[model samples]
Target: MSKKFLDDAYNLNSSQETQDLYQDWAASYDDEVAENGYATPRRVAAALWAHLPEPQTPILDYGCGTGLSGLALHETGFRALDGMDPTPKMLEGAQAKGVYRNLKGFDIDDPAPLQNGAYSVIAAIGVIGTGAAPPETFDLLMKALPKSGILAFSFNDHTLDDPAFTSRLTDWVDTGAARILFRESGPHLPRQNLNSDVILLEKA
Candidate 1:
């Protein structure tokens, strides 16, 4: 990725201005992404659910823009869905779907608001790069789960090959903090000029 992308990705929590930018973008996000066919959220959600612990697992859809992942999760038989995002407009879009039990403004860098051991699965689809949360946030979220808690998330396809992020992810898997359940590379969305690698990480 370019330096700008990495900077935006790693510096998501650096200020309030960036947060506002996302809020502004949320309103037209669906229309903007529609051009790309919105393939990522569905693909990632499906891969994640396939490796989940159980059907009734309570899932936290981290950065769940417009409830895309939440809707997909529900269709896959996941119940007890909750959504969190920094943008109220984004949450508004998600709330309209009525699939989430709870929706709140969440800063991924500060996950203290989320209860510890309260989720069996956490999915942060399209929430790990450029103008989003950093990769370390995944570690924090996973730590919130109990042993054997399932974590299914995706990184932009471009980031999957980045050395810094890849190394960190590999470390987690190599150390047994998490196990790789599934990984797939495919078009996430064509309009957003994005692709992603959906990876399911299960906490051990």
Candidate 2:
């Protein structure tokens, strides 16, 4: 990924902006990230597997983004996945992979019930902290998860510097709604010299 692309991702201010950004980049998005050595998707899948290894476990790949994360999940032996993304083009790309049980094109801000709160696991992957998914994305996801539902996600270095993101995570733990199962900083993209922290949370 180019510096401009990375910067644009973090600086987005609205869902429309995020949708437009992905619409423009959807074609090259997968290859671009791969060329940059994107590892977060695989890492996110691995983290989720640690807590919920059952292949039959239902999963919601929130902000799935061209289905790369969903594919990662399938590759790791989790197949029962439903994906949702804000960008139609991106979601289309994901659909072609034929891995998800369902692929819906809707922004996180949209007023729609996701799986009617039935998912055992929700993988946000590279969604939160970045401007791609708004801060409220967390609350929305938590609402969709029943007690004991796990969330797997990641935060790049730029997002880690933002106290708003980190503080909200602490609040999740402090409020006794969730417990941290895994968190560790690791390579994000070697070419970009960036690193991110992978996190796993189990809702209480």
Candidate 3:
């Protein structure tokens, strides 16, 4: 068995460190998270589907580590899915799932890799927060959406406790840039006693 990395997931201090950690953890990510009862992906996918409710609508699963999020989206009836991640090893796992129409890998330092308005609905499930993508990533995804576009994502208990993370969500809503369509807190990794907030935002 591989050494467990989930315990150190939130302690990563840099983008390179984060990428390297996923590279090593990619193979066992699904199994380990499943063992811990990972639930955010399903919850986020359902929330997004409830608002969009269009299976054919194209979705970009940004930071789609290992395609678990993509699988959840597919299970919710979404078919036109594209995924992007910074870790190639993680992308390999995602590719094996065969759910995304396209999967791409990007440089972690590439601040604006996504073409603006390319996806009507972009998901960042488990992408942002303490040890993952930074707060500015929320801005990047929001900027990539066209008017009335949707962004569905999650913030785990660790992230929700940080003002830096929650403030980004509020900044967009408070500034009239986006509107909250759905926000619910529920199980994330039930076995670990973790919880997360599944949030959906429509670009205004």
Candidate 4:
């Protein structure tokens, strides 16, 4: 896909609209991603696993589209996995794999469904920068982690370069909301965007 197409994918007016679009596209979602080499999901899952304190800990996979990230985490030894995505069709695809113990719809904007300090590890792969959820959702997700909990997430190169977005993220790190574990920038998977960053954050 061209940069314009990738960029336009995230131009939704609201998160709800994005979910609806994904629900409509769920049937062909895997095929569509296969064409892109599944860059964001694969890279984000790898980066997350690499910095985890315990590879076998239970994890919550946010925006777990078609269970790609969930499958990657399971392959890395995370056996206890739960998935949350707003699109039910996507969750159905994930469910068919029988990898997640629990799969449910989630709204990143409202963190009420998740218990505080619940997950040892949390992942938001391929959800950011695509109008999948807002950056403020990060704060909500962070609050769901205990002190020193691990978080693995990815963002597109363009999103990383956004001054306002990066500023907000940096402020969280500065205030000890989350501590940086690792930040890697390179080709995502095989045939997607040129360069994206996978960041590992630890709840502080």
Prediction RMSDs, each to the true structure: 4.4, 2.1, 0.8, 3.1
| Model 1 lDDT on a 0 to 1 scale | 0.74
lDDT of 2 by residue, 1-204 (tens): 343355577778877787788888888788888888999889888887876789989888988889999999999999799998878889889999999998887644676647556786889988887676756677778778888888888988888988878777888899998999999899888788989999998889
lDDT tens digits by residue: candidate 1, 1-204: 211122233345464756765676667676656655777778876786666636667788988877888988888777788998877888899999889999988663464757889887788887775456655776677888888887777778566756656776788899988888888888876655667888887788
* Better candidate number, 2 or 4, judged by TM-score: 2
- lDDT ranking of the models: 3, 2, 4, 1
For residues 64-183, write the lDDT of model 4, one tens digit per residue: 888988888887777889999878899999998788999998664465767887787889887766456777767767888898887788877667776655775688899878788888
Per-residue C-alpha lDDT of model 3 across residues 92-119, encoded as one tens digit per residue: 9999999999999999999899999899
Error in Å for residue 81 of model 2: 0.9
- Stretches off by above 4 angstroms in model 4 are 1-8, 53-55, 107-111, 189-192
Give per-residue lDDT, candidate 3, residue 54. Answer: 89
Model 1, position 166, has a per-residue lDDT of: 75
In candidate 3, stretches whose alpha carbon ends up further than 4 angstroms from where it belongs are: none
Pairs that collide in candidate 4 are: none
Q: What TM-score goes with each of the models?
A: 0.85, 0.92, 0.98, 0.87
Worst 10 residues of 1 by lDDT: 1-10
